[model samples]
Target chain A: MRSAADAAEPAPPVRSRPGGRTARIRTQVLDAVTAELAEHGYDGLSMDAVAARAGVHRATVYRRWQEVGGLLADLFDAAGNQRWDPRDTGSLHGDLAALNHEIQDSFTEQPSLAMALIAASFRSEEAARALRRLWDERYTQSEIIVERAIQRGELPSDVDARALLIAATAPLYHHLVLLRTPPDPHLPELAATTATLAAGAGAFTR
Target chain B: MRSAADAAEPAPPVRSRPGGRTARIRTQVLDAVTAELAEHGYDGLSMDAVAARAGVHRATVYRRWQEVGGLLADLFDAAGNQRWDPRDTGSLHGDLAALNHEIQDSFTEQPSLAMALIAASFRSEEAARALRRLWDERYTQSEIIVERAIQRGELPSDVDARALLIAATAPLYHHLVLLRTPPDPHLPELAATTATLAAGAGAFTR
Candidate 1:
């Protein structure tokens, strides 16, 4: 059976520590998995390929990750753990527009991690749940933007944060990802401005 | 080589002409493709499986479709030919809400054609391009809702129909598909209202 240490993230440690070795190996394996996923997508991803790419023993990957689920779970967990923060642009429109730009960039870039993970979710139930949880966390993190707007008297205090946030960003994804349209440089701000104006007019009140 | 009759869609045929045979075969093959995609997805889809499912000869399937790309292209073409039109609810709010409900239902239904095709697009370039064209066609058809809103003096005459329509429906997809959120009964009306209000205020004016 895998030990608790194996199931949990290793603590920060010096190179000589056992935890450091575990951390190092985990980083290498996850990085390899990311590279494989980006280059060939979830269909081409395999434990053997990941092991070879990481220069780790195949048996180790099999024993630890067990199969694709564990690998994907960890991959999504790593993403959620990243130091992501909403840009504080001193106004709701600026913050939302900046957030939209970040999302736009993520999907438009070649071999995009955002696109890879979203596509993987379609094929794997485990991956789909993981992505759902990740979005939950992201939206939770971004709720502060709405709170800031309310505090600044820019939006009604009772505006539905989730509804407004979805409005401000959904256009970019709708056009680029679903419609596969060329990125319009004006879309990010247009959507944000629309949402902000609507919020100010009490359209998104809960 | 396949005959020119086999290369194009048969005109409304009475089932006795050569084109009738071609049209019949095409319908069987495309129906099988949709069934295979809904049940097994793109990864499990194969020309052999499609042939067996359709009760057609394997060699005929190979001769006609050549590969998955041909199958997807034809499937999308069949979808584009359907006689679909936006609801005429006599007001911007009613029309937008009705359109949102259609989108919401399409994705919520079990073995959803909408969800299946969207997921398939992520895995195949041909499927992706076909989906884009299908969206382009769908958006064009739905544009009349905005035009109607303008003629009724509910929105500015110059409102960008594409942008307004995208805003009206995007929240449903963003929440359901990307965020994997549970179906919100009120989201359809809420999103439509937000977009309609914003459009009336000239946020979507070109």
Candidate 2:
């Protein structure tokens, strides 16, 4: 649970949102949860600890989240909302490269959190469902990248957009999770290039 | 920890080895560890449980392994020795297909064990090293597939054999671990074909 994140420099403060009291409290709780997860991992997380860390009443946390799984689901929902916008970069390759870079940055900035969440998903069905929903949201949002590419004749009309996106990101996850190593610096570029080549060759086509 | 492996059929008995008493004890202990891991995962595993299951003395288990990490390392070593042999199938595509099929079959046959090991690796440094060593041995064994292709001029001499192997297997892991879904039956074929196309295009070459 406690690993490199314990030794690495602290992350920057969570940004203040222009919101009312309830919204502000929610943000504080979520921020505390993130820090707890990064330091102790999902298995070590506790509502009492989160409440103490957030300086909120334990009753408030109990009333709001009810359990760890509910809190995790809310966290994932917030993450989905805050996900990097994959803008149109003029071509499929450029768009995929941008997405891969964003993924790589997320992993680099929060390796322990990323690994903890993955481990949690395997241990808990609730966490797995939350993760699946999070990925589904991201996948749906990013499909526009391939859709636009198809319209521009950059990819085959029959290409499976979701499959293509998975192809681009799968190797990075493989390296981080299975190989238990930091991905190569060039991994994003290689993933983009490989997915682009495979797509162009109709390997991703239904 | 205790999940599908609890309900699924019991694994077949370990075969008797033609060796001394020490070897027989080692085999029994290893077999007990596998069954324990498959049922309770690494986190829930206890030396007492393994010793009781193996019908060996607790003192013997402690004297041999000393800790869960040592037991895991020994389990991984036994797994490496029993790993599926990836034969040369003449063509790179055929060889890759065979390898993917084996990976897919392993996952399908023992989903709980696969997931438990993955989760264990994240939680313990010793498990991570053991898993890495297991993969390294498998990757080294499978390198002959790409090497033969290079010799036949079917792949570029500069193609990275390990990277290609990783690419072919990455998506399946992504589907199983990240997506939390059963992989498509055609995934092995798709993975092999996509990797073949990408490697042919030099996407895996340095």
Candidate 3:
């Protein structure tokens, strides 16, 4: 089903020349991991199953990944190292809405990689830590959206970056992930506008 | 080793004879399910283990509940039937903050039942539906908080109750569950206050 993660990584890593055997094998194996997670979740994820799907030797998969948890940690590590620049849409509202839309898109994808990986974290501590790092990086990277807003005079100087960012994005996660509700088209704009108004009012003041 | 749900159910059920053997047996078995889930998560949940823990005959466990998924469904049903009123602390801010605190408490308890059961939903359809119903009930009940605020002139009459409620509580879940960060003591009031201001600004107008 290749469910694990066509969407997990933003784009395909270069296919042939530069990276060599180690990199190619890792890609194949990790891609298999994502597919396995999508189809079966962590409970059904196994090294043998991943090896069979990846067409790699079981001994090789075992040597590299060691276990199912290793496969998850590496999948997240691969994702963590990907490049994801928050799109600059010129206005704070536009920028935050873009960010929320991106989140909604990832979460809504068939066999959603975001959903599978997050679900994996509950059963695997290694995967959980890796998920934490990935989110930390994404959140840190997104803060520049808020930084630009401040420079653009869209927000007050005392706005707490973490608090503001979380406020702006938390509703999407709350609605999509926690409530498991069908995607709401109004959510991206509604949440962004709420965060923008609240930020303007100094609700997220440090 | 009951990781499933000491916190899942809010309190100890009546220990003695008000409910007869059938009811008592159900409670005992469900308690065992919660404990097993708490210790091992869904991956470790088993009918045998539940039977052993509950001190009920194995045939009895199999006869009624049927399987692991059945146990989760009943636990949630039991929780769904419980009486839970959103506290009226005389103001929207106080009421929402108090609501957030209760969520935080349920999610922070040792082997947090809320976390365990929510995690289980990712694996079981029955549990997922039950969770959806439970959340629906809670959200519907909590609309009174907004209703009260509108009555008290604290917010506009057009507030989208669901949207405001999600904004008010999403951060705690985002922090404790998704981001896996330590709890911030200020979170309850902070989130409640933000939702309050945003509602006043008409950000959640339906």
Candidate 4:
């Protein structure tokens, strides 16, 4: 019988020609890192294991990334830059609900990877830098939703966009990470509504 | 010179007779565990290290707690039951600000232990259970503040107390754990005010 770990092995990396050979290698290596993280978590992750899983030479992994933190930083950069895109749904509530849904889905679908990244951010400076960069990028992009809402007169002009955005997603994160609760189906709607109401009331001003 | 790790070594457990020998041993063992966690985190925590630090025999440590999770559960039980008491400041704003202050202090004062416990909760069933239990206890007690506010006509009776409480503290935890940012001195006040505003506006209503 296949072990649960083996069954959960990440699918082999897709060979892409977008950036040529170097990009393909990078993609392969990162996919392997993701798989390793899912299976063994940050503590059990090792360069040798990632290389072996990626079918790349250990020296190649070492020469490029230098260490686990560097590799993870690159992974965060790639994931954040490539995956997260701002939504302009014409209304702040719709846009926030969409964003909340995405955040909830990420946590629910890739719990191990999410938890590992969160833990690594706390434990490693490199990971922390990478995670911060990712959040900064995402937050910057998403702020437009609030900006549009302000222009549309849906929210106060002085509303703190970042604070509103963070408040919308904080409860879900607090429940998932700190409370260890299962995903609540109502969370996205609740977060969006609460954020909207708070913004309207000037709770996020300044 | 002693390294930073060695200098940060947890102080020896205090001898106490308030709860008798078994209770004293439990206290000593838990204190040692907290120290070990602070120094090395959950990944590096070992029963042998805990026993050594607690000045208890390995057999004793093994015989009682059985594993790290068991030890952590007991610690959570003790800490949750003894430490987190709800404040009755006659107003939701005052109570929430006090609660946020405590959460912020926990993260600021003992980051290592807090991060370790959080990471452990993500990685282990035992830790998750303990974490959930701790949250449940705290949320249940703190909900009374919202309940009282409703009676006092300060908030809508339909407001979701747990959601309000979680939202108030989520951003602080997000900044601390995910962004790895330095603590903002104003976080407690901001959290309390945001929560109070949102609750008053019925954003947290079910």
Best TM-score goes to which candidate?
3
Model 2 agreement with the true structure over B1-206: per-residue lDDT tens digits: 11122222232222344678777778778778778887788767899999999899999999999988888777766665553457688898888887777666656775467666666777767877887877777788788889899999999888888888888878888887677676689988888999999888878887
Reference interface contacts recovered per candidate: 0.81, 0.79, 0.82, 0.81
Instruction: Give the DockQ (C-alpha) for candidate 4.
Output: 0.63
Off by over 4 Å in 3: A1-7, A13-18, B1-19
Instruction: Indicate which candidate wins on lDDT.
Output: 3
lDDT of 1 by residue, B1-206 (tens): 00011112222322222466677888778878878877777787899999999889999999998998789877776676565678899999999999888878777767666677778888888888877777777788889998888788888787889888889888888887778788899999999999987876778888
lDDT of 4 by residue, B146-197 (tens): 8888898898878888888888778877787666678898888897888888
Minimal lDDT window, size 10, model 1 chain B: B1-10
Query: A63-84 in candidate 2: lDDT tens per residue?
Result: 9999888777676666655534
- The Cα RMSD across the true interface for model 2 is 1.1
Clashes of each: 0, 0, 10, 0
Docking class of 2: medium
TM-score of each: 0.90, 0.88, 0.92, 0.87
Restricted to chain B, the TM-score per model reads 0.89, 0.86, 0.89, 0.84
lDDT of each: 0.77, 0.75, 0.81, 0.74
lDDT of 4 at A192: 87
Off-target runs (Cα >4 Å) in candidate 4 are A1-19, A110-112, B1-19, B110-112
Q: What value does the lDDT take at residue A195 in candidate 1?
A: 94
Worst 10 residues of 3 chain B by lDDT: B1-10
lDDT of 1 at B25: 82
